[model samples]
Target: MNGRITVRIMTVVILYHPTMLLNLSSRHIPCPAKTIFGRRGPLVIEIGHGNGSFLRHLAIRHPDWNLLGAESSLGSVSRTFRRLKHAGTTNVRLYHGSGLFILRNVVPVNSVHRVYINFPDPWPKKRHQDRRLLQSSFFKLAAGRLAPSGSIWLTTDHAEYFDFSVANGKAAPHFSVDTTADPPAAARKTKYARRWIDEGKIIYHARFCKESEPAHPIKPTITTQPGTMHHAILQGTIPDVDAFEKQVHAFDSGHVILLDAARPLGDDRLILFVRVDEPELTQELLVEVRPHEQGVFVGVMPFARPLSTPGTRAAIRITSRWLEGCGLRLQQQSF
Candidate 1:
C-alpha cells in the first residue's frame, strides 16, 4: 500500500465534498434514523461496503429496507457516498466508523433485521489475527443487538478466514450457523466478488441466525453530559507553552496521549487535541485551555461531542496540572 497515493486521494475527495460523510456519533440515539424514503421498514447493515458498488444495487433492489453502511476508510466512505448519491437513492445512509462502534452505540438493540459483511479484509497473517473483525466478542455483541429473526451474512474469498469465521459462528452461544457454498447473487455483483468469481475462486458464504437475545446482554452505557461540556475553570495569566511535543500518560483504567497542541495568534485560547484510550472506549478530543471571564478554563471543545468519561475528566485534571507546570494559578476547579 502506497501511503502517498492514499493521502493524495483522501485529500482530493475530502477537499471536493466534505459533507458526503455522515456523523455516526450523533445520528443514532435510542434508535437509528428511521423513515427513509418516507417509509419505515426493516434495517439492513452492510459492514465494509468497500466501493459502494454492491451497496448501490442492494439499496436499489430493496427500496423499502433501510441500508446502513458502516465503513472506516474515509476514501471508501466518500466513494460509496458519491455512488449512492449519483444513483439518487434515499434508503441508504453511511456511518463513518467501525461496524462495532455503530452497532454497539448507535443502532437500537434487536432492531437490525439483517447484516451483510462482504469480502472483509482477511488479515491472513497469523501475527495480525488479533486485529481480525470476526471474534467471539464481536459475535456476542452482534447476537445481543440482532432481532430474534435477524441473521448475519458473511462472504470472503480467503478459505482460511472463511473456515475460521464459520468455526466461531457455530460456537457462538446465541447463533445458529448455516453455511452456503456461494454468497447471495447480489454480493457477487460487486467488483470484489466478481473478480474472485472470474478467477474461479471458491467463495464461502455463511448465515448466522440469532437463537435468542442474550439474557444478560452486555449493553455498555455511555454517560452523557447535559449539553456537551467537560471542563474546569481557573484564573491566571497563561504562561508561554514552550513547545508542543508528544506526551503519553498511563493509568490503570486507561492511558492518555497529548498528541498535538495548537493556539491562534492574538488569542489566549490554547487548543490541544489528545487521544484518550480506555478499557473499551477510544476518543480523540480537542481540549481548550484558555482565558475566561473568571480566569482560565479547561474543557473539552464543543466542536465534536466526545463521550465524557472518567478518562476525560482525568484529562482535564491532568491538563490543569500540566498548565500549572507551565505557569497557571488555580482559582477554582470544576471537572
Candidate 2:
C-alpha cells in the first residue's frame, strides 16, 4: 500500500483553514461566553460542528466576524482541530464541551449575536425525548444568553425533530420561531445538509429570536444526585472532586470509566470528561468541572428539580461529602 497516496486520499475529505499572517495564538483561547471578539465583528457560535467544513467555510467567507464552534464528540473535535490547524485559519475557536454548557457558562448573557445547531442527533425514541437539545428548557436558556437581536439558526433532516423544534421554539415564551424550507441565501451550507437535500430529505430550518420574556418567569433547572459528579465533568464545566469520587465509588467495580482532560483551542478553559458504562445515566449526571490551578477547581451540579426537595437535598449532601473528601469544592445551582 502506498502510504503517500493513502494520505492524499484522506486529505481530500479533510479541509484545512487558510494560513494568514495573523496571530493564531490569540484566536485560540476560550474566553467567557459573553466575551466579544474582533472589536466590532459579530460573534457567531456553531454547535455540533461535524468535520468543521461548514465552520471553515463560514470563517473564510465572513472574515469580519469571529466564529466559535462547540463540538462534544472527541472524534469530531480532533478532526475539527486538525482542519483548523492545517488550514492555518486563526479566526476560529473550538470547544470540546457541550453546546448548552458553553452557552450557560463560557458565554456571557446577552453576548452572542448568532447561534447555530446543525445536524444534531435526533433522539428518536419517545422515552428519550428529553435528550433532544431543542427542548423547552434549552430554548429558555438560549433565549436568556442570546443578545437582544441575536438569532438561533437550526437545521435538521429528521422531520420529527424539525417539527418538534418548531413547536418548542414557538411555545418558548421569549422566542419567536420562524421556519424555512431553504437555507438563507447567505448562510454557508454544510456537507451533511447538502447530502440530505440531495437524498430528498426536506431540510427544515428555523430561526429563533427572543422577542419578549414570558408572562410568568420560566425557571429552568436540571436536577441530578450528588453521586453523579462525573456527568458534569464531561460537559466541560468544573466539577466537585469530592462528590465526584463518591459518585464513582457508587458504581459497580466492573463498570468502565473514561476520563479525558482537554483544553479548548484558544482558551484557558480546561474540559474534563468522566465517562461511564451507562450512556443515559452518564448524560444525566454530567456536571461542569472547571480547574482553577492545575488540578483544583469548583464543580457546579444542577438539580433536576429544586434542591429544596428532601430527596434532592439528601443526595446533594452525600455527593458534597464525597467531593470534599476528594479535594474538590462543590457548589449547587438550581438553574
How would you encode candidate 2's per-residue C-alpha lDDT over 182-293 as one tens digit per residue?
A: 6654333676877777888877788998886434433323323323332211112333222222234233222323233334466544333333332212232222335543
Query: What do the candidate models score in CA lDDT, each in turn?
Result: 0.75, 0.57
Tens-place lDDT per residue, model 1, 1-335, is: 22553454355445243333444333324454462223578888899998899888888898888888888776787788789889988778776567876677667778889999999889999999877877788898888778787999998888999888889988889998998456778887787889998999988899989988787765744534445445777766666665777789985678888876767688888877777887546766778888888888898875544666667877887788888877776667666
* Model 2 spans > 4 angstroms off: 1-40, 185-189, 213-247, 250-335
Q: Extract clashing residue pairs from model 1.
A: 234-296
Top lDDT hit? 1
lDDT of 1 at 179: 89
Off by over 4 Å in 1: 1-39, 221-226, 251-253, 278-282, 309-311, 330-334
Candidate 2 worst ten-residue window by lDDT? 20-29
